[model samples]
Target: MTTIEAPRSRPTRRRGVNWEKWGWLYMRFSGILLVVLIFGHLLVNLFLGDGVSAIDFAFVAGKLADPFWIVWDTLLLWLALIHGANGMRTLTNDYARGKLRVVLLVLLAGATVVLLVLGTLVLTTFDPCIGDSTVDALIEACAAQ
Candidate 1:
């Protein structure tokens, strides 16, 4: 029987920013921030004032009217979505194979970016007086100023 020979392998050291390490750091950082933001959100929206009974269309309109809440929510959206997407990327890498792995990663990244853009636009450009049904309410609220 002929002897089998192992294939030769080459070793090359990588340099510069360790993105995976940064990604890991980001996950931990974002996770901590998410806990604060999420809990604060739940506390304010679900437990404060009139509680769940106070949550209505007008309540949302009123909150979004303020710039502070808008910024808070925007950050929350960005951090949570990125954290979740990255976590899912880790999972996909663990389970997927070859071309399928690359495809999944691309799709995940694309979806995350699209969602972030859309969500940010919605938050920043939100016009409470857009539709007819709630236009009156928003107008009245604005006019009250």
Candidate 2:
């Protein structure tokens, strides 16, 4: 009868901060927050007031005029953008290889940054009176400030 050798232990690896673990955790928490934020946003915008028919430029201007809505939209923009980018990055790492993977990652990062910057700028610097002075209510509101 042949004698079997003892089983080997797992190999040692370098010690460092595990980014994948943090990323996984972030995905879970962010997903939960995103659902709440998205539903609240949809409920207020699409289901309340006059609904879809009331979604004109004036309505958007009014919404953005409030600091609460501005902050809400900014949160929505940043969280959604980063969440999507992280998901796409995970996919890229899993399925892509070589130069293709690098290129995709670079493109994804660039797009995410660009969108975040632009979206934040739009939210923070939005002037509700920039267009369409034809609406009497908007005209009065703009003049009041």
Candidate 3:
């Protein structure tokens, strides 16, 4: 017995902007920006000053004290997370199979959303003095009066 093949047809055209195309463009643009942001962040935090040896809670708290560093770090976090997530989605589409692909993609997207929300909250709502001991040296040096 011979099996019959079903005929294939073209999909109808839509009359609106193609969001997928914009998303693709956005991923590339954000990826380039992330490269710069991430490297600059690393260079400043790990290579500048006394190199990695100077990286402590006090150093980070000092940086977060400034609104400029807060905005810069916040933008870096947002862009890198989004670019990295989109890159993972591309990899997932290339390798994941069948129902497992759908499940993995759903989990990735959910995790990305949760991470972005939490990261943003931390950047925006962070208080350097939140856990400071009353006698903390840096707190006395930097805390707002």
Which digits, one per residue and each the tens of the lDDT, describe model 3 over residues 1-145?
A: 5555566755557889986678799898987887888888999988988889998877887788899988888898788887788889889989998899999999999999999899889988987677754547856765755
Whole-model lDDT, model 2: 0.90
Off by over 4 Å in 2: 1-13
**lDDT string, candidate 2, 51-97, tens digits:** 88888778888889799999999999988899999999999999999
Residue 35, model 2: Cα distance from true site in angstroms: 1.0
Name the TM-score of candidate 2.
0.83
Q: Please give the lDDT score at residue 19 for candidate 3.
A: 69
Steric clashes per prediction: 0, 0, 0
Among the numbered candidates, top lDDT falls to 2
Question: lDDT score, residue 139, model 2?
Answer: 92
User: Which 10 successive residues of model 2 have the least lDDT summed?
Assistant: 3-12
True-structure RMSD, every candidate: 5.4, 5.7, 4.6
TM, every model: 0.80, 0.83, 0.81
**Reference-based lDDT, each prediction:** 0.89, 0.90, 0.83
Off by over 4 Å in 1: 1-13, 49-54, 142-145
The candidates, ranked best first by TM-score, are 2, 3, 1
